[model samples]
Target: MDPARASIDLATKIANAVSTVSAQPWEILTERNPDGGRTFEAADIARLQQIRSEYATLSMRGNVFCFREAFDYPGFSINEYCRDLHPNPVGESINLKIQAWSESHGIWIPGISEHCHDIAAFLHPEAGEDRFIAVAKCLSVDWYLNDSIGREWAPTMSPAGQANAMALREHIVEISRAMKVAPDAPLIDKACVEMLLEMQALSGHPTWFSRFLEMWIGHVQRSCGNINAENLGQVPDVFTYLQNSPHQSGLYYTLAHFEFSRDEYLDWSTLTEYCLASDVRNLCWLCALIGGLSNDLISFEKEFVTHQSQSNFVVVLMLNYPALTLGEVVEAIMMILRDLMEHFVTLSGALKNRCAGRHGTPAFRATGIFVQAVEWGIMTTWVWQTRSQRYQHARSIFRETQQG
Candidate 1:
């Protein structure tokens, strides 16, 4: 809570109040005003609601895009979401009015349908077609949607959020019990809830919902010039063995690196399913394949040992149950990487079994260590790049720990 954030929070109520609601609301804006007043433009509202489906709308591409990826598409339109809520299949005069209103309000005015101009004059009276679109695009719909999703505001309030919220209330109750009083605030403030309810129509409320779009776009361009390697912190207390035994620390760290990378692969697959490849072909392709080379691995031969080479598909899945939670890609690659590591570990044990010159494959293990450190270095970069909004301090700490 720095001065800037403090100041923003202090006057947030006024700032929030100034934001305008959509021009698209027919019954609400036309039939009824923002205040509790009423409007009876039932005919007009019905028409707009009908065509709402066909109009271009704003929405996140998918849930995957929610936490990762950046949205670069510029124009803002509600065509997508409207249809979901209300499909305006017929083109009527009021349909045209919807278009005119969109144009006047800088909304990406949809093409006029047969339903045009019943309620010719509008209340807000948009400036013109282009300006209306500009205004609509300029709306902070992205921020609003993202904030709602992240806060788990509406969705959370329903069941999941409420469950956690109840626990939270219990804590509050404890504090209250200490003082003795119960809260009287409405379950959720109406004004706050309105933002989410407003977005209920979209395919994904924050469609093309790249919350980290700005930072990721910048990172991909290398505008920030890749700072991953320069950010590996010393092995933390949790990995004390790695810190004390730099060599061993490196090995386990390497294993962890492979694990994390495989996990991201799973996340990426889940994302593809949620947004990009929602078709049959993509699903099949996703389901098929060697699962591809894991982004992180110590060695092929070492990993092969742990992997049951002859296991059938079903057994493989069962053995890899914990790994699957990593999502998809990571799971597949990890199986491979595990097999390779096990093989190497076995080879080393065999030498010790025969009372050979060396009891351990120090060099093989050593290489694994280096790989982990490097992988960790890359992860440090990825987190800062992909999750910068949520993890602001990651980059700085990474730099401090890993910088040459």
Candidate 2:
């Protein structure tokens, strides 16, 4: 076989295995996994570990692919998981709060209130119940307020709306300043304000949570620019979109929150090593690239229907590569996702190894946790978008094909 063909073949296999393995929780297979305290069947654990080890090897060789044409949209069922592992009252309360908050704010987020438990389980399976519930609530509030309300409620077409949005950005700046002295400081929505306060209370470093708010504000400001472009009937070019992608995807806040939310409080040095390290920053960018592309590919149909595909990568590809049909553009994007995934996996492994070597050091452990959290973020975001009804509303050829 030709070497290039050989790589493609190996890449194809790896991609297929990843889709299958990732949809199922690895926590079921191992009690020792980083995911919060969820139980998995012993048999499944053995198989998943084998696949994970294989993926690590193939990824190192640069022969692994992340997704392919034969992909199935495997949506996770909140009801099923809840049935499997009954959540306590706190988990139940948070779920209700998420839904109520979303509904009151004119946002539509399917399964989030119910899915919060599963998300908490999937992301922090080894965590205690209290820790898991707090994390779940934080994630729910973040997604609801940041993605849903921020996108839906903002005025995208008028000067006044834009001005109003800017005013909100100023409030975020104030909120960040207040978190150090008064985490419960006043804000626009009491629920969101309370949610941030709760997250701050739970976090090892409340300052990190404040920083997350600042990053979120930055993303909101940049998003206003994108919406303004759309209002002017201008689509951002591929280069411009890439430049704005990290903030647009809310990567900074998510990464910052993960750094602070750990059960173990990281010291200043470890926090610096994880947050400011060049390699770690690069890894985050790569993860954002994967996440942005995956989101574009998954949500392309809805976005296109809503006339929001102007900034979408798939649309960008179609515009750039006119000879390619939409189907071809989708496939090309998948290949790009795979290529990026390979890079992400390789970098993550390198970071893990570097940290692992410093066994007894706090900075080393913090670095290790950061890499693991990034991996989880990349994979979980993929899985969530795949299953999310929020992005599944628009009917398109791509949606039909995925279903078929």
| Per-model C-alpha RMSD | 29.3, 14.5
Q: Write the per-residue lDDT of candidate 1 for residues 1-404, one digit (tens) a residue.
A: 34334333322421232113212231232122121212323442333233222111211111111221111112312122112221112323334544444344332213322121211112012223332222222222222222232111222234565355444333332332232223543322221222222322221314221221221121112111111111111111111211111111122212222222222111224324434222212221111111111111111111111221111221122122212221232233333333323333343334233323322444323233323323233223223223223222211212211112
Poorest 10 consecutive residues by lDDT, candidate 2: 29-38
Best by TM-score: 2
For candidate 2, the lDDT comes to 0.52
Weakest ten-residue segment in model 1 by summed lDDT: 223-232
Question: What C-alpha lDDT does candidate 1 achieve relative to the native structure?
Answer: 0.24
* lDDT by residue for model 2 (184-233), tens: 54333444555566766777764676556666665655543325233434
For all predicted structures, in order, the TM-scores are 0.17, 0.62
Candidate 1 Cα deviation (angstroms), residue 52: 52
Q: Each candidate: what lDDT?
A: 0.24, 0.52
